[model samples]
Target: MSSSEVECGPSFPELIRRKRDGGQLSKQEIGAFMRGITSGSIQEGQIGAMLMAIWQKGMVAEETVALTQEMMHSGEVLQWPKAWDGLVVDKHSTGGVGDKISLSLAPALAACGVKVPMISGRGLAHTGGTLDKLESIPGFTVTQPVEKIRQILEDVGCCIVGQTETLVPADRVMYALRDATSTVDSLPLITGSILSKKGAEGLNALVLDVKFGKAALYKDLDSARGLAQSMVTVGNGMGIRTGAVLSRMDAPIGRMVGNTLEVCEALECLKGQGPDDLEELVKSLGGYLLWMSGRTASLEQGQEALAKVLHNGAALQKFEAMLQAQGVSADIARSLCSSQCDYFLHLKPAEHKTELTAQSDGTVVDIDGMVLAQVLHALGAGRTKAGEPINHSVGAELLVILGQKVKKGEPWLRIHYDSPAPNAKQHSDLQAALLVGKADSYLASPRVAEFILPPKM
Candidate 1:
């Protein structure tokens, strides 16, 4: 057997039994559990049972630590050059609607002299995926061999790609089992799944954007905070400097939602002309990451440094370079990044377009993000099951921002879709997403509500 494959250990039922009844597991026991799956000694049914057990009876700090470490070690742990230490960094998001922060943040960080080997995944259920967004660019490649990935990092300073086959193999088997078992939201399992892949990347520091709101995985602050704390502790325990940003996901992040539309918005963000909320998130997340890696004196200073790159054209240049490094043609990359170029000319746009208008006059209060995600998912922008193909051109664009006053018959949202367009009910749902409230109670909420840092070791 290869050294990366985990070795089989003690009784599987014994570990399941101990965890089922709320008993703590030793590091050796958890290691065995992770290895058994990686070694093919564990069955899927038992894996499901243990997932439920972890869901029902939560893990203690030590057990969580063991599970994260074991999962990370179940496959090949990536190696970097000696000089890259403390300069390699990454950011992960517990996803939400229209969350395309990574698209702008990774390349921007690279421009700041950080090495970003970003491993991303596809969209499942309602939340959009970074890989899916990047795929909208005709020739952008999301997978690269280790040698090429290293070269890209050395040249471009950043590369967003998928987890290699040998990287975090244990999480591959068990992570798939999570959704089917209804234990998808379990805290320990989430930490293990997220941090394991990141740990395999040999990162020196990590930042998490753990979202919470109507459209977020955790619907409230307390639930999201618990998951964030669990991830922070587990991540730090695994020897990676880690922290989290608690951001609200009540509405779609930018002026757009879906694969291609988000890519366009992200490009605009790269040019320092995107929506206020989207730009804020990129700066806030990237700023915290820079501070976590000790590149800046404070979080605010880190933000200013990042913002400087965005407006000065350095970050956008890195993004154009990243596109070509990842397989996009040089001409296409340059044109798309150019200020005078139109994005839709080079990228695919939907076959049909429909606009929705405001029916009454009032200040806009809420635009339901969950509603938009579901509608867009139905329109072929998302996948119900893994490996299902999505329509990159299918998406929606907001014509008005939150708190804007609109008169009757004013166009509020424009949807792009293919033939067999949205039915009456779907159209109604889209209209329902926009909510207007009296102007008296207009209070603009912060996109980033709180920043949670790791405790000093």
Candidate 2:
């Protein structure tokens, strides 16, 4: 059947009913629904119903591929010059707290000779967003026209920006509907939403950082693995080389957990001196992309190359170049890279503060990332809804981390705030989030649990 005929063939209600009853949808049926969505022929109610149905019944691999492809084609699919071949690659992480890998990884990959056009989003719920962190820099902008994005990529080999309204219209509508309908967790829906955007970017290769545990989108390992596998399957099925790594998010990836602070932490990582877990995660994800794009012979080799750029200051230079390309002053970027402490000193300090000291001498067994993120959100570090303002400077800092032994009077967390101090309940909650136990009971968790590659063709 012709594409037009497919759109005219099925009634929207019938399609929803079929999927609701566990019936597999044909490519034409899925394509028709997507077109209806893009054209406004499908009402929001209908979309919500279909999403709920799919959430309940789930979708098969083929159905997911169809949805992703249709969404990718619903708007412009970016195309680079033929001469550039396929040096383009990008990474997407299932949101997590203190997950600022993109800030460093983009420039790191670009320094390794791959072009990175990273389209990021804002913080939703407890997970922090890349665009939010970038905007925390003085005079840095996240919104840009497509021509400008192209220009920045050509000049800097990378640009991290938000999704343009016209880039993938279908996913934009579907994402809002998913957010409203509580269907964000469906494996197929996530696979479609993520790959649709990445596919639309016209990437040569893609890396998926699927995180699980208390602070991540998926709370369990099995579910996170399923989502990762589904995304890889659909992405490769659509011809974009994809790989995934399952990482633990039981604790925040780095020491800082707020906007400006996370950006500062990323700057430290670029200079070869951030938290070990954050640096290692960036290397693992960047190395996979390098290997997938054939920049390195193997993952180990790719990591070695990344390490070279990091230690030799090439990655930091690339990052500064990207910042300047985005309109930050060269002096400011250089100062941020060279002396972050001095750079931070100029920013206004929060008006109120409180410190939480260790109750007894012991080892830090766990710092619940989800609870900490919630506390940060309550303190105005993150947005509870879209378009809300983030405090940027107001957040809690972890003075002690996992497996560290602390004395009774040692401070483990310091809360920075601008207004009234945290009330009694907030104080109790913050204290409960930190777990201290016997020194020998501390068992550190591995950061990278498993590395998954696209299935053999």
Q: So what's the TM-score on candidate 1?
A: 0.97
Model 2 pairs whose backbones collide: none
Q: What would the per-residue lDDT of candidate 1 be over residues 1-457, giving only the tens digit for each residue?
A: 3222324444778778878999999898788777778878778898999999999999998998899999999988889999998999999998988888999999999999999999999998999999999999989999899999999999999999988998989998888899889998888999999999999999999999999999999999999999999999998999999999999999899989999999999999999898999989999999988998989989999999889998999999999999999999999999999997799988999999999999789999889999999998998999988899999999999998889998889999999999669999998998899998788757899899998898862
Model 2 misplaced regions, further than 4 Å: 1-6, 339-341, 345-348
Residue 98 accuracy (lDDT) in model 2: 90
- RMSD over all Cα atoms, model 2: 2.1
Lowest lDDT block of 10, candidate 1: 1-10
Q: How far is candidate 1 from the true structure (C-alpha RMSD, Å)?
A: 2.3
RMSD of each: 2.3, 2.1
- The alpha-carbon deviation from the true structure for residue 327 of candidate 2, after best TM-score superposition, in angstroms, is 1.4
The digit string of per-residue lDDT tens for model 2 on 1-457 reads 3322445676788888889999999998888888888888777898999999999999888999999999999999888867556799999999898999999999999899999999999997898989988887887888888888888888889999988888889988999999999998888998998999999899989999999998888889999998889999899999999999999998888888888778878888998988999988989999998998888889999988888887788999899999899978877877787744565653445677789988888899999999888888887888878989888777777999899999998999988888656878888887888899997788777799999998762
